[model samples]
Target: MNRLQLAKRLAAMSVVLPAAASFIWEELLWLHALALLWLAGAAICWIGIERKHHSGQMRRTIHTLQAASNRTLNHHRHDWMNDLQVLYGYIRMQKPDKMVECVEKIKDRMAEESRIAKLGEPALIHYIQSFRTLTNAVQLRVEIAEGVHLTELPVDSSGISESLIEIMNAYRFAAAPALGEPAVLTMKLSMDDHALYAAFYYQGELTSEQRFASKINQQLEGAPLRPVEAGQPYGNMLLRAEWRA
Candidate 1:
């Protein structure tokens, strides 16, 4: 441990040991008061130490989040630059067909991003939008049905967001990187008259299929939505879940 931690432990031991001895062999009233004073000092020291540790943790978390945000912004900027370069190249080559295709792709991507932003849960929106910058192990394709807002549902939004993040993490950690290209994970969110549906389609190689399935199941335990089914069809994994209104 660091010197600060070692010192705190030493200080705690000194006060506690003296207090214990005083209680065991005290012959005077003043000795009891001294023991109580030592006990109070120990408590104060413990509270201070805990507060300091928590404050440090909070600062670190903020720093990490800021760094991630900066990275995501850079990635987005780079993507736009590349897109513009491609469009410029197409225009210079006098190829109108490829230029139209590239513009359509950009429009679609922006529309999807706009939908994700209005998902009604800040945490889930951030998680989904920043996921690309978080890792390179998986390519995430999120499809949110038009007019579907998560907050409109009667279920717990936070729980749904947490469960979705955990599910994504399961695939992210289980996918084999060296086997081939990064895996593609598609998440489709749709709503019906009485329920909401989330379907996960994973098309890629996993280090261990059983382990990935186990992790997904474990993460979904006690989640807001119930698992409808998990199966493999055409050598691809499909997991479906639904939340009734």
Candidate 2:
């Protein structure tokens, strides 16, 4: 039951209470029974409110986490695609030195992003690692700090991943036909004792600013389940969500 339900029940009970008290055989018994009923109602109301609040918060938190995960996946996929393209060109041109250099650099970058593995969430990690076939022609790069670990992540991380996916997809879809290729979004993941952090840097130009902004606001729905910031060069975004250990 929610707050409205509890309120409705209380209203109904309030009407019944007067009739109930009047029918009691003794005044003392009526007084005691009425007091108990009122107390019960109040307790129910409080519980309803608390539950409702908790449920909403949980939903938002999960969604935010999921968005992060999805964006990370997409970014990884973008980078992997670039590597494949470079390899294809190198193999065709027979440029051994260039191929080796690029391959080594990619390896280094992958190692840096691998720090997210310490977050202790397999589903999210796997999903992020397999980012490909995104809704838009966007590039994503995920980087994680060294020696950073988030020991106790929630069992389900799809919510935040989904949030990120939604944002990107919406932005790309809203871009006009003339807008052409999507921008690159660099995602960096980190965490402290209290929160998980996701910092985004976008490096693409949108044809229609108003349309993109409108789509983004609609996608986010203005609910910061976690603290977030957005502004500056190319409108980068940040999310800092508390994590409980």
Candidate 3:
């Protein structure tokens, strides 16, 4: 059974045991004490179980954030190398005009990258600082909506940040190319009613091979990975929240 069901069962036992002890064994004080002790143990166990559940969720959040950060860094390194190569080629050609244009383009790209890198700077940096051992081979692009401020969200900043990271990582993995140049991944976040909405857009063209791998006829209900066709490779992944009455 689920955690909530288990908690409810323990609660019912706790109430029933105390009442039964009082009515069926009035003269047995030791029995009454033992029943109370059992009830107390059950309560403790229920609390521990809840704690563990939350802890596991937090751990998963951290892992997702780490993966996204690594992907972003790798993408940045690849782009930087590509820019340098272009600059080198222009220099060798001895075309002063073209060389100047290449330098200007590289500067503009660096400025944009620096701005994005600053948005999630310290927090994202600290999370992935220890991940110097892994090799990353993907490209990513993070796009923050103009005039959007993540700090204005009503939820805890850390949770919102981690959720963004998770969404980005999911997009990175789903959009990574199996061949040819890596795809571009964009992360956008907005807010409504104390809830944050995130959207990840990946640009690419879906091939016949992807359509065949979908197993459309055999899909289970509520599958985590849903096959979406958006006029070929340009599709988006969205995450949102809803309130219940």
In lDDT terms, which candidate is top? 1
TM agreement with the true structure for every prediction: 0.84, 0.46, 0.46
State the lDDT at 23 in candidate 1: 73
Ranking by lDDT: 1, 2, 3
Candidate 2, residues 55-82: lDDT per residue as tens digits?
8989999998788777766776787899
Query: Whole-model Cα lDDT per candidate?
Result: 0.79, 0.64, 0.56
Full ranking by TM-score = 1, 2, 3
lDDT of 3 by residue, 52-140 (tens): 77888899999987787787678668867988898889888888898899889888776555544444535644433322222233345
Model 1 lDDT per residue over 1-245, tens place: 96557767876887867777787887877878888888788878877887887788899999998998898888889988999999999999999999999999999989998999877998888788788987788899999999767786676777888888888888788877855677898988887766667777888877887887778768877777666654544134343435543
- Which of the predicted structures, 2 or 3, would earn the higher lDDT when compared with the native? 2
How accurate locally is residue 29 in candidate 1, as Cα lDDT from 0 to 100? 75
lDDT of 3 at 124: 46
Q: How many backbone clashes does candidate 1 have?
A: 0
Deviation from native of the Cα of residue 18 in model 3, angstroms:
6.0
